[model samples]
Target: MSRRPVHSVRSVTAAAAALAAVGALTAAATPASAHAPVHPRAARHVLLLSVDGLHQADLAWYIARHPHSALARLAGGGVEYTHARTTNPSDSFPGMVGQLTGGDPGTTGVYYDDTYSSALLPAGTTKCAGVKPGAEVDLTEDLDKNQDSLDAGQGLSGLPGSILQMTGNPTTLLDPAKLPVDPKTCRPVYPHSYLRVNTVFEVARTAGLRTAWSDKHAAYDILNGPSGKGIQDLFTPEINSKAVGYAAGADWTKDNAGTEQYDGYKVRAVLNEIDGYDHSRTHKVGTPAVFGMNFQSVSTAQKLPASDGLTGGYQAKGVPGPLLAKNLDFVDQQVGALLTELRTRHLADSTTVILSAKHGQSPTDPTALNRIDDGPLLDGLNAAWKAAHPGAGDLVAHAVDDDAMLIWLTDRSQAAADFAKAYLLARSGTGNGIDGKARPFTASGLQTLYAGTAAARYFHARPGDDRVPDLVGVTQYGVVYTGGKGKIAEHGGAHADDLDVPLVVSGAAAPHGVRVDSPVRTTQIAPTILRLLGLDPRSLDAVRIEHTRTLPAR
Candidate 1:
C-alpha cells in the first residue's frame, strides 16, 4: 500500500484543532502526563528480556513441568498471553522489526533477514546486489540532518535523503574506531556488523532514559552499526567489545568453546550493569530506566548436528532432541540467575520484563530428512525456466527460510512471469517441490495476501523495489526445501508452528497469573510498551488487542 504522506506539524495541529471544535477528538493526541508516583517508593525501571527461539509451547511446558521456573514465577506475579502469535511468514529479522517498530512487513518493509530490492539504488545502478557497501561508521550526524530536512518537506513523496541512502545501500563492515581494543591481543574482536534498524534502546536514550543491552547474535551486538545510529552507552561482554573475535579459531561445536563460553561470561557483564546501586553516579538515576538482554545458547544448540548428542557425553535415547531440551533447561537456569540478580538489586518489582523469542524453529520432519547433497528443486526449475526465456535477465531466486522460496526476475517482460508460473506448477508435490503447497499465483494473489482484504492498500511503487519476489512458493506443514540431504526441521514459512510465539509480561504493575487467549501480532509489542510507559501509541501502526485497564494507572 502506498504510504500515507507524512503530514506537516502545522497541518496536523490545524486538523486536530478542527476535530476538537466538532468534539470528535479529546486529549488523546496530547502527550500523556508524566507518570505520578504511585507509592512513595515505587520502581520506575523496565527490563525487556528476549529468549532466542523460545516457543510458546516451550514456555508453557516449562511452566507446567517446573512451577518454580523463572517464567512461571513471573507469570504468577503478572500476565501471560497464552494465545500470543506472531505475523504470517515469520522469521527472525521481520519478527524483531515488528516488535521494535510496531509495524508488520507491509509497513516496516522488512520481510526477511535479507530483503533484496534493486529499487534501493538510483535509476543508473544495474545490479541488485546485497546490502550497499560502506565503512560501518556512525550516521547520527547524517540522520539528524536528514530528519530536519524531512521535517521541512513533510509532504514530499519517497523517504528522506538519509533514510533512502541508508536503506538503499548494503551495510559496511564495523569501523575499527568504534570497537573496543583487546589489551592482550592489541586488536579488535567480535562479529561487529549486520544490523539495520533504529531499535528501542535508541528511542529510550533520546527520551533521557539510561539503557543497556546484552545480546548473543551479531545482529544484536551491532546495534551501533548502520541500524543503531542514535544509541549511546550499551554495556556488553568484554569478548564482544572488539569488532572481531580472537583469531584462535574457536570451535562452535565444543561444549564450552566459542560463543557458548563467551555468552556464559557475558551474563556477568549484564549483571554488573543491573547490580550497580549508585545509578545516580553510574547510569544516572531516574534516567537509568530501560535494560534488556538476549540469550542465544539454545538457538546455537539447535544448529548442532543431530547426531552429536548432548554435552558431557550425556547421550539420552534421543539424538539432538534430548540435547535441545537439556540446553533449554540450561538457558532457563541462566534466566533464573538474572532474575535473582534483579531481585537482589530490588529492581524486579519496578521493572516490566518481557520474555519472547525472535523466531521459533520447526523440528525436522522425522519422516523426511536429508542433507545438502544436490541442487534444490526450485533451483532446477529456475535454471530450466531461464533457459526457456532467454530474454529474462539474471533471475534472482532465493531461499529465505526452510519452507519458503522467493523468485525475482530482473526482466518484467511477459515471458518471465509465464515461465516462472509453468515451472513452479510442474514441481508441486511432497518431494518434487514445496510439498504440494506451491500454488503459483499472479501479482494479484500476492497483493491479496499482502493486503489481507480487497479494501487494503498497496505500497512499494518505489524505484528500488523492482527486486521484490514476483512469485513466492510456500510449503505445507512438515515440508521443508532442501538439497540432496534434507533437514528434519526448518522455519521461514506461513505455517502456524513457525509464526506463533509466546508473549509474557510480568512486573508489579501487571495482572497476576492472567492468561490472555486473544490472537495478537508481534507488531503490537512496541506500542504496548509505549502504552505501558504512558506514551502516545498512535505513532505506531500496531493494533492494540488486549484491554490493559488492569495495568496500574499512571
Candidate 2:
C-alpha cells in the first residue's frame, strides 16, 4: 500500500529554482541554507479541511461533549491553538484566501467577493478608452455562465457527470461577460487575476507536488493564484445552484439538510482523492500532496431557522442548538470517514491533517439578536446627499453590509465623506429623513463610523486606494444589518465570535493533546503547510511579503 513520495528533495530544489526564475520566488525570499528538507518523513501529504463557522468555543464544547468524535480525536492527537483567529471582516473569500496565501485583504487585494474596485471598469463596457474605472467585482455565483444551473451552463449530454463536472477549466464556468474589465488593458479580469498574492497550492505545484481542492463555488478558482494553474484537480460544486431531490427553488444552503447534501458532494470528492484518484473518481491520478475541501453545513446550520420552533445560533456562548449540534456531528462523521480512508491506504502516519474554520457566526447567544434593515439606511444616506447637492446623483456607488457596512462612494472626496458621516451621526436617533419613515439605525448599535482616510487606514491602505472603502460602519456585537426572520446570526465582522475560530494541527510529528494559548492567525496556515511538506516557506510570495511564519512548535 506504500508509494513513492510525490516530491523529493532534489526535485523541490530544482522546482524552487525554476519558480525563482519565473518570479514566483525571489533569491532574497528564502535563504540558500533553508533549502535542506526537514521533517521529510513526518508529512508527505497534507490534508487541510475548513469547517466553516466553527468557533473555538464550539470546538471546545463539542470535544467536551462528544469525546469520541473525530474532531475530538484530532485535537487529542494534535496541537490545538485555543486563541486562533481568522481575518477581520471574516467573509469566506478573504478568510479562505488568508489561509491559502498567508496574507490579509491588504496584501492579497481581496476584501470581499462582491466588493467594489475603483480601478476597474464595469462588466460589458466595451470602450474603456476614457471611461471612469469603477465597478462591483462579483466573484460569486452571479459570475457563473449559468447561475441557475448545477454545472454552470455546461450542458449535460449524459448521466453521472452533470453536477460538479468540468468540461474545461474552472475559469470557463465564469462568464467573461460578467467579469469586471481592467481599464488599463480593456480585458475582462478572471478570479485568478483578481488576486494580488500567490497561494500555497501555487508553491506546492511549482515544487513538483500534486495539488487538488473542492469548494462551494466556482469563484474559488481564485485559489489558483496569479498563475491560474495551481490546482491540478479543482472541483467546485455550486452550492447556490438548485438542489437535487429537492424543490425547484431550493438551493443547498437554504436549510441544514440541503447543506449537508452539498457538503457530501465535496466529501465524496475528497474520498476519491484519498483513494489515489482524481476528484471525479474517473481518473486514477496518484494521491495529491495537498488536497481538501470546505464544509458549509455548520455555517448553514448557524444561520437558518430550525423547523422545531427553535431558532438557529447558539443557546449560549460556545453552545449549540439542536440543529447546530446535528450538523457538528455530521461534520465529525465526515472527518472520521476521511481518517478511516487514510489509515486503510496506509497514509495516516505520513499525512498531516490541519482542521480549522474560515469564520465563525456572531451573536452566538440568541438573546443578543438585533436585526436591522440596511436598505433604508443606505437609501436615507443617498437621499440626504442628493438633497444637499442637487443633480449630484447618488453618493453611494455600492454598499456591502452584513453585521458591518462597507460603503464605496461615487465620489471619494473628503468633503463628500465628511458630509455623509455628519449626516449619519446627526440622525443616529429615531427620526425620519428623505425616506419619510422612522430611521432603522439606533444610536447604541451604529455608533462607530470610519470615513475617507480613516476607513482606508483601517484596512491598511492609503487614502483613495481603489479597493479600500470610503466609509465603513461597524455595528455593535448584537446588531446584524438585515430585516429577515430566516437568519438569527451572521459573520463578516471584527467581533470575537466572527474571527475566533478553531485551529488543530494533527500528525505523527505534532505534539499530542497540547493546547497552545498564544494568538495565531489563519494566515499562518500557508507557511505552516509548506514547512510540513519540507519546503521553504518563504518561497510563497505572500509569505515573503508578509513575513508570515510557520505554526509555533510544541
Candidate 3:
C-alpha cells in the first residue's frame, strides 16, 4: 500500500491510447525484448498466472482440441511440463504459497488456509495475558469486514457491478480485529506476517524491481511474504462476497456465471497493470517487473452442481462438461486478452509468461463423487473420547476437512492421536459405526491416515510442533468430505487428481513447442521467476532453505 505517485492519467480510455502510442515508439526504438540491449538473456518482466483447479490432463485435453486457443498458443511457444505437481493436500493457501515461496507446507509451515496453530491466541484476544495460545487461523472471506458485501465494508451500501469500484489497499479491507492475535506480543497476526518465508515478490522487490499481484481474498496478503512489503500493487477483490448484479442468494463460487464475473474483475485489473497503471487504473504506477492474477471461473465450474439447466463438473476423466467447457473457454479468452495486451504494449518479447495452477479439482469423473460429511464424524470422535476418558471436553481443537482432514487436538499427546486414529479407522468400514448412521467411509473412502509422529514426519516437523496438525487424513481418489448438494467435486486432497496441475512457461528464453515429461513441482516457480528476471534464486529465503532449483528447461 505504501507507494510513490506517477504521472497523472485523465481516464482509462486516455491511458490505453497513451500506452498504445508509447508501444509504437518502443517497438520502433528497441528490439522486441525491452531490455535486449542491456540484458539479453533475462526477461525484463514476468507475467505469472495461476488457473486454479486446472489439471495437467485438462491442459492437454484443451490444447489438443482447441489448437488455437490461448493455452494452446502458450504451449506452442512454451515449455509444457506434463507432470507438474502442486503441493500435497492441495489447498489454495499452501498451494499458492508453494509457487510464490519455493517451499511446501513442510518448510513454509502453512498447511491450509484454515489451520490451527498452538502458538497463536484467539482473534480479538487483547493482551493474550494468560489466555490460551491456540486458535484457528482463518484466511478466508471471513476476514472481510463485511463478507456479504462486494465492497467488504469499504464503502456505502448498494454499490455494485465490480469489486474494482471498491478502493484503498487490499490489506486495509481486512479488519485487524478479525485476525488471530500473537500471544508473544499481544499483536494481531496479519496474513503477511503468518507466512514463514519470503516470496518471489519479496525477492524481486529487494532487487529494486516493482512487483504486483491479484488474488481472491485479502488473506492473499500472504503473498507479500514475511517482509510484508513484497508486492507494491496487491489487488484482492473478495471472491466469496455477494455477486454483483445478482440476487443476495447468488455468490461467485455458487454459480459458473457469477464466478466468471468475479474473474473478469481480476482480468481487468491485470489488463490495467499491463497498461502501466495500478490495479484500479486511477494512477500510473508503471508496469511491474513481476505481476499476475489467478482465474477462479474454471475452478468454480468444476465444483458447482447443475442449476437452472446448466451443468458443471467433468463428464468423464479428463473430459469437461458443457458448463465446465464454457468456463474453460472463458479463462482461455481472458488469457488471450492478457497476451494480446502484452503484445499491444510491446512487452510480450520482454516478458516471461508462466501459466500454472495452485491446485486441481478431485475426481474429474463426476460419477466418482462420494459426499461424506466429516462434521458428524468429528462429533462422534469427540463423544467417543469423552466416553473413554469420562471427561476431557473435546479432543479436537479444530479440524479442517475437505477431501482431506487435518486435525489439531486440544491434547497433543501421542496416545490421544492413537485413540482418534483407531476410532476413525474402525468407523471407516461399512454399516452403522458412529452416531447410529452409516459409516462415513463406507465406500472405502479413506485411503491413508497419519497420526502423531507419523503426521509430524510427513510434514518434516518434530512431534508437538505448534503449526503441524496432530492427524492428517488422505482420502480415496473419489472421496470429497462434503454433504452439500451444490457441489459434485472438491479439492484439497493428496490424490493425483488434486495435486497434478498444469505448468506452462512461455516467452523470452523459453524453448518453443517443447514438452518436458519429467516430474516437477509448482514450488520451482518462485526460483524460476527470479531466474527469469536475472535475479538470484537463492535470494529467496524459502528457495535457500528448501534448496529449490529453477524449473527445468528442455
By TM-score: ranked, best first: 2, 3, 1
- Candidate 3 residue-wise lDDT, 1-554, digit = tens: 01123222232233222212112011122221222222223688999999999998888888888999999999899778777889876999999999998888878889998999999999998966889788989999999888877666687555555456565357888888989999878999999999888788887776678888888888888998887888898887778887766656677787778788888888898899899998878889899999999999889888877643677788877789888888788888999999999999999998889999999998887656667877778999999999999867999999988888889999998999999998887775332211224543542257778899999988777677899999998887677776555567788888888888999889876767866665678998886776677656666667666677676654
Alpha carbon lDDT at 182, candidate 3: 90
lDDT tens string, model 2, 300-405?
A: 8898767334456677766898889888899999999999999999999888899999998887876666777777677888999898899889999988888777
* Model 2 stretches with alpha carbons more than 4 Å out: 1-41, 157-164, 307-311, 428-441
Q: Which residue runs does candidate 1 get wrong by more than 4 Å?
A: 1-43, 121-199, 217-228, 234-262, 277-287, 303-308, 311-320, 368-374, 397-399, 412-415, 428-468, 484-487, 539-554
Please give the lDDT score at residue 442 for candidate 1.
30
Cα-based lDDT at residue 161, candidate 2? 41
Candidate 3, superposed: residue stretches over 4 Å from native: 1-41, 156-158, 428-440
The TM-scores of all predictions, comma-separated, are 0.66, 0.90, 0.90
Better of 1 and 2 by TM-score: 2
CA shift at 303, candidate 3, in angstroms?
Answer: 0.6
Indicate the worst ten consecutive residues by lDDT in candidate 2. Answer: 18-27
lDDT by residue (tens digit), candidate 1, 426-478: 45233422232233323211212221111112222232343334555454444
Q: What C-alpha lDDT do the candidate models reach, one value each?
A: 0.46, 0.79, 0.79
Determine the backbone clash count of candidate 2. Answer: 0
